[model samples]
Target: MAKSFTKMLRAPDSPVKLSKIPSDAHPGVDSKADALRKLPKFAGRLADLQERLFAQAHGGTKPARQNLLLVLQGMDTSGKGGTVKHVAGVMDPGGLRINSFKAPTKEELAHDFLWRIRKALPAPGMVGVFDRSHYEDVLIVRVRDLVPRDRWELRYGLINEFEQELADQGTTVVKCFLHISRDTQKKRLLARLDDPTKLWKYNTNDVAERKLWPAYQEAYESVLNLTSTETAPWYVIPADRKWYRNYAITRLLVETLERIDPQWPPADYDIETEKKRVLAS
Candidate 1:
């Protein structure tokens, strides 16, 4: 049997050296055409499973309390938005909740770091996608020294406990770190500058952040090592190739929903009686 993307991409339990892992490697896929060919099949399966999950929730009196939360974290221009557009966009919109986190507001800053994160969780039977999620509290917040050392340092354990609670409550947390090379990022950034249509996507801060590439990488390495728990493990997706990245994530989503195996709830009323009433009408 072919290996599952989940197994192939899942980060190891021990510490990982990001510098050693190649960002351009495309495992289990031959080429962009190969990935594109396989995606539609996976999309069909994904749509069906998503419908089953949503039906289970809205159907019978005893609703299933399972949901999925896909957390996307990566360096600048790692294709987080593109992944959402291609992968989660193919699923039923009624069953998907997408939230993109940005710089914290004054009100958000008043509360604990996870205050906003708690509100963005996916409802039962829904697939939630977080674009640059709670990890920012550690990643950017640490790299930029937005907060003091002791506070941000302690958030690692807090995040672990929070994810564990989600797992216990039937939430399958799929954390993916979209790994890309420095050169690829530079080309992508340059492309943004070269194209008038893509200028809106570029930010001056991106260049400034690029200068801190090594620091961001070090922070990511720590995140992968520290918070990759058994319940909510991290997957390092080689995202230099956009086609493979989309395909890998879609495969992971399909396998996860299949594992849940949500079923169609039986009708509460008698089918014969309903049929007879409809005929009489």
Candidate 2:
């Protein structure tokens, strides 16, 4: 089932038009209620797999330790934060590291773009979540013309190489673009403005950014085309319906972890001896 969705949602090598994809489509999910009901089971499996991965990294004899990094990229109000809150929230916080990347600091700009990203990577046996990532160097920089075209254009290969290195080092990279339609984004933004509690989330800059929607979409299309490699492919998740978004992401995670298939390390000490020692004590 996961394989089917992976095939359906993965970006192909050809050019893509974000408008062509339906943001509200729920493949294989019958209804919102059904999605909600299945979420807990996927969540539980994710927790268990994460625990096993953590244990294996700590105790397994393998030379390269294993970890998972989930990279989320999306437009404003496209559900990146919500995905982290709902899907990743189910995992044990002790084993998870959620990093939200904003505009680079003066110090960060001093070094290469990936320097900060390297610092935020998950350690062996941990699951790391990046709310926005290195792709920003291409997306926002290109859209806002923060950097010259020549500079930002060079980053596609660099980003691909960086992810390839991570894969070589035993990190499973799962990238998701929370694909939302223009109308859906506007509706969500309006909702945030109308609700007092969500007013804080409504940023004036978001409105400014929306004015460049076409440019951002083109930038993202480039991102998906150039960087969706076999080692770390990108999944374009439908984000119009919050419930379905959560379900799809949770399922993707579970599937990725299952593929990694970490196991409980064998006991280093004799189990009988430990049991007897504890009982005697």
Error of 1 at 268 (Å): 2.4
lDDT of 1 by residue, 162-271 (tens): 99999999899999999999999999999999999999999999989999999999999999999998889999999999998999998898888888999998887888
Q: What is the C-alpha lDDT of each candidate?
A: 0.92, 0.90
Rate residue 265 of model 1 by lDDT.
80
TM-score versus the correct structure, for each prediction: 0.97, 0.96
User: How many steric overlaps are in each model, in order?
Assistant: 0, 0
- Report residue 10 deviation for candidate 1 (angstroms): 0.5
Clashing pairs in 1: none
Instruction: Provide the lowest-lDDT 10-residue window in model 1.
Output: 53-62
lDDT tens string, model 2, 1-281?
Answer: 23466666787767777878788899868999988887888889999999998988887356238999999999999999998898889899999999999999999999999999999999999999999999999999999888899899899999999999999999999999999999999999999999999999988899899999999999999998889999999999988999988988888888888889999998767889999999999
